[model samples]
Target: MSLDQAAAVMEQQARACRNMAAPLYADLLVHTAEDVRAGGPCADAVAGWTGAPSTAAVPLRLLGGVHALVLTGQAPQLARFYPSAGGAYRPEDADAAWAAFRAVVADRRDAVRGWLRRPPQTNEVGRANLLLAGLLHAVQESRGLPVRLVELGASAGLNLRADRFRVAAPGFAWGPEDSPVRLPGAWRDGVPGWLREAARSYPELTVVERLGCDVTPLDPGSEDGALALRAYLWPEHTARATRLGGALELARRVPARVDRVGAAEFLAGLDPRPGTLTVVWHSVMRQYVPADEWARVTAELDRLAAAGAPFAHLLFEPYEQDGRHRFQLRARIGAGPERVLAEAHPHGLPAWTV
Candidate 1:
């Protein structure tokens, strides 16, 4: 992509970051984008980026690299801009931070480019609350049988442990109350009756198998893998970071396997079992997939549905509704009609039941 196009995309991503409660990252990315347009060190650091500017997540990858530097204590000067590192965010400090950021990029140009070569793997454990709710809805419809879950784009596979994480909303709660990973502010509207019943009747899921696939799956047990996951998170969002830590600990106790395979290839090898509810789930990952591969993935989903074993497909993705981008939970069981279950924040908090 041209420098101009990349700059514009970064600017748009900056606005999105601000809207999503990441002002620090938004400010840093805005400056980075400007520096790129001005043909400076930041431009050189991003010179090797070859993915589509619009959807490559280029801005986030760059930010992740810088965040990694701060996390690893490689750039002490940049620590003042990171709230998670005990720095306070002041609107006036953005300019000085930008200068420091640019200097760091120039000094660590090769390291920054290395980050751009890989996709951001946020894992985003907070999103598990929404996915768990969707799973419960599917279970209620499918005779409450044990489920075998196969997730696409599972990243570190943290959400595979969703059933083990604590979830609380007004008038409802699920999972272990004492669990370290707590997801509060779960629903904007009151919890639905279906969800309440599902939680009450089946407090813990009988997950027979949990399998996931990603183009590059991260092992939560590895130091580098943990660093990558943490770096992708906006440093100012302490809650998300805490939840990730909890998920990592939980992953050590309750293990799940994530294969290094493409989504379509993973689905092609899956088949339904007669007595189990075979559920395919993914969250906020469909956009990154190529159209041709996604077409094949859809066909595989149809094949699973038609296989006659109890089946469900749950997805949480951005859907344009009335000219607004809203993330919605959608579910399809067997050959039944697709249902729009709820609308949710991009991070899966404060869901509004439909």
Candidate 2:
């Protein structure tokens, strides 16, 4: 691809970052876009890329790479501009911060390019809020049956331990008070009556099993794996970083296994047991799966449903509805029809009924 084309891709992602309240990444991305257009180090970092920009998330890959450099102490000059590294991004010092970021990309050119080869790996813990909500709905529908939780594209299997995380919203509260991962203000407007009642009725969840699949599963217990997860976080958002820290810490105490396999392959081997409710769930990772493979996944889900052995399918993914992109929490139980339980933020916060 031409340098100008790549630069445009960077600019597009910059707009996204701005919209998502990541001023640090937005500023860096905008400056990097200019560098790419000027055929500077940023251009070389993304040279010869030929995929749909949004699909590849090229800008995020590059920024995450640079963030890793700071986190790992490879680019100390850039660390001061990154909050995740105990530094701050000041609007008044934008030029100086850009200079530091540019220098890092130029010096660590190969490292930035290495990151471009891999897609962004962000297993956002905030999304667990929505997933847990769906799981609770599933449990309630299945009459308090012990759940066999299965996740597709669960990066670190962190959300597999969603049951253990503390969740609080208007008229709704659950999980251990002393839990490390605490999701507060979950529903923006007001807690849906159904969810509130479900939370009250169940009060606690019993997850008898936790298994997930990713093409390349990351071990949250490993130093490199944990660092990668942290590196991908936008430096300015301390809350996100804090939540991830807690999830990583919790991963050590919890036993959630993520196998290395395609989603369809993983689901193909499973069938619902009589006693436990098999809840198949995924969040934000649906776009990564190809349509044909997803067809297989749906087929597998249908097979489980037909088996009629206390099965549930839960999804917290984006959908085009009501003339806008909606991030929805949808669920179905046994042979029941699927329905949207609620709509939520992409990172799974502040949910409201559809």
**Local distance difference test, each candidate:** 0.89, 0.87
TM-score computed on alpha carbons, candidate 1? 0.97
Task: Write down the worst ten-residue block by lDDT for model 2.
Answer: 47-56
After superposition, candidate 1 runs with Cα above 4 Å error: none
Tell me which residue pairs clash in candidate 1.
none
Q: Estimated TM-score per prediction? A: 0.97, 0.97
Tens digit of lDDT per residue, candidate 1, span 1-354? 788778888899999999988888889889888888999888888877734656789898999998888899998898887987777688889888888889989999889889988898899887887899989998988878999988999999999888889899978889998787999989887898888998888888899898999998999999999999999999889999999999999988888999999999999999999989998999999999999999999999999999999999999999987998889989998889889888888888878888
Q: Per-residue error at 259 for model 2, in Å?
A: 0.7
Stretches of candidate 2 above 4 Å error? none
Whole-model lDDT, candidate 1? 0.89
Model 2, 1-354: lDDT tens digits are 577788888888888888998888888888988998888888878875744546788888888898888999998887888889888888876788889989988998888888777678879999988888888888888789998999999999999998989999866688999999999989898888777778888888888999999997888999979988988889988898898999988999999989999999999999899989999999998899999999999999999999969999999999997797899999988778999998988888778787
Clashing pairs in 2: none
